[model samples]
Target: MTNQGTRQRFSPYITFSREEWRHLRDSTPLPLTEAELEQLRGINERVSMDEVADIYLPLSRLLNLYVAATQNLYQATNTFLGHLEAKVPYIIGIAGSVAVGKSTTARIIQALLARWPNHPKVDLVTTDGFLYPNRVLEERGLMKRKGFPESYDVRRLIQFVADVKSGKPEVLAPVYSHLTYDIVPGEFIRIRQPDIMILEGLNVLQTNPDGGRKRAPQVFVSDFFDFSIYVDAKEEHIKRWYVERFQTLRETAFRDEKSYFRRYADLTAEEAERTALSIWEEINAVNLRENIAPTRNRAHLILEKAEDHTVRQVLLRKL
Candidate 1:
């Protein structure tokens, strides 16, 4: 295989057997209680309280440390320059394949980190909001590539992150509606300079420098990130997760009258299964291979999941 192919296939110091992963999971502390687990029952059933306590709890604790260290570093830099400047928000980027449990990771991290004493204000944003409106995509003949990099308003996304990192007064991100399968007009989530921002998406770590005789500018979404995480799992496992989530939605979210996917609400189980598989193959899998998976090494930490959606092993980038 070529060098590119080899990197695509594997990463050194980032692989683990299932059993070893289980030992790690077993050794991790569980910070969430049974009552809290019950609270998260419906929204994210795939990841249990045990999963949060064992995997995400520890991860949140580590992030707290990183945030504190960053604050001190910024303060020292300011003191050396003899200028008083407020600390910038610590930005985190989370990347993963479709249905690889990244949204859950983002949400879980948001909740956990908010509970941390040091970082009281934690904001979570998904790149879904950064996607162009469906009308724009349809006008450009890119409706089918909705989750691909080209489907996004990349310039707007970059600007939003840059503004946030720059400590702008307030930055508002467009809100996306899964029900309408489009960006909501005039609806946004405002971030008021939080202590930390968790930005989650498929290709948050992917970067492509401007190609020119003069290096125009090298800015990718990850350029603004203080740290990043890539959620990793076998392709087959992710495919199964996609299908399973589809099935779940068919019974729940798809049934909502306001849901854009309401048309699929009446699909029989077998029909739904087939439709799910087709969508995964055509849209998600292609994006995963072409855009998302290649950026794994760029993350500061990697969470590898198993077929059942449990975090099997974690790979921490060596300091």
Candidate 2:
């Protein structure tokens, strides 16, 4: 079954099966090879070539058409106003719960969109960089809520996207290190002018937090997006994925002495499984229920996945 509200008969989205979506690809050649697919796939996630051909090829083609249409509309509007307005980057937002394969989806889309002739300068950025530094979280007593919306520098993140949307020549985003589980000091990722930009995160689809007060000016990160995608799966499936990924990391990244989770590397298999479950139950699951899942309906498209991490169905919101 699909997520809540998706089951409504009068829903705005048109659901499509995997086979139906695959048929829409037509003659679009798969631009990525097996090696590239391996590089893009996330830990404990399975994204095969067939999966890409069936799901992403058509998505990239659809996005290409949207980009072309948007450019034409921009030109027409400029002509009507008798002014040559500057072209800004087309922004796409990708949101999903942790361990739901959002990173892989964003990376694959970035690769495919960049290969398109119209937008060869596609750039991808994750909201991880916008997260408040560890020191700030600790000071605020929000270390346990690291991935929560309150843990982010929302104003700065919004401003960065606003600058890019306003056709700024260059914008810089802070750098985040997963191994250290913190932001790197004085490090930033520079994004030059590009035809397309993909912003990926767990909270990208969330609305303003004004408690419905209509104040002077309220803007959300998603306001600048031309399109948005939400990767979804059953809560049970996601919990299992998270535990599995945690175990895998314990054997690999957690073994690094400098890694933030180095202590987990010494856990026995049984102990590791129990610890992983406890972390998910106490932290990740709470965040998903209270913050992330509520915003799923805000996406223009929803890719629902199965237990195996394969996208089982596609739901495209009607225009």
Which candidate number maximizes TM-score?
2
Cα displacement (angstroms), candidate 1, residue 35, comes to 4.0
The residue pairs that clash in candidate 2, if any, are none
Q: Candidates' TM-scores?
A: 0.87, 0.94
* Predicted candidate 1 versus true structure: per-residue lDDT over 59-173, tens digit per residue: 7877888999999898899989999775579999999988887877887788788887788899999999999888888998889988887778778999999999999879999
lDDT for each residue of candidate 2 in 1-319, tens digit (9 for 90 to 100): 5665456557879888899999989899999999999999999888999999999999999999999999889889999999987668999999999999999999999999999888899989999999999999999898998888888888899999999898888899999999999999999989897999999998998774322343523789999999999999999999999989999999999999999999999999889999999989898999898889999999999999999999999999998
For each of the candidates, the C-alpha root-mean-square deviation to the true structure, in angstroms, is: 4.5, 2.9
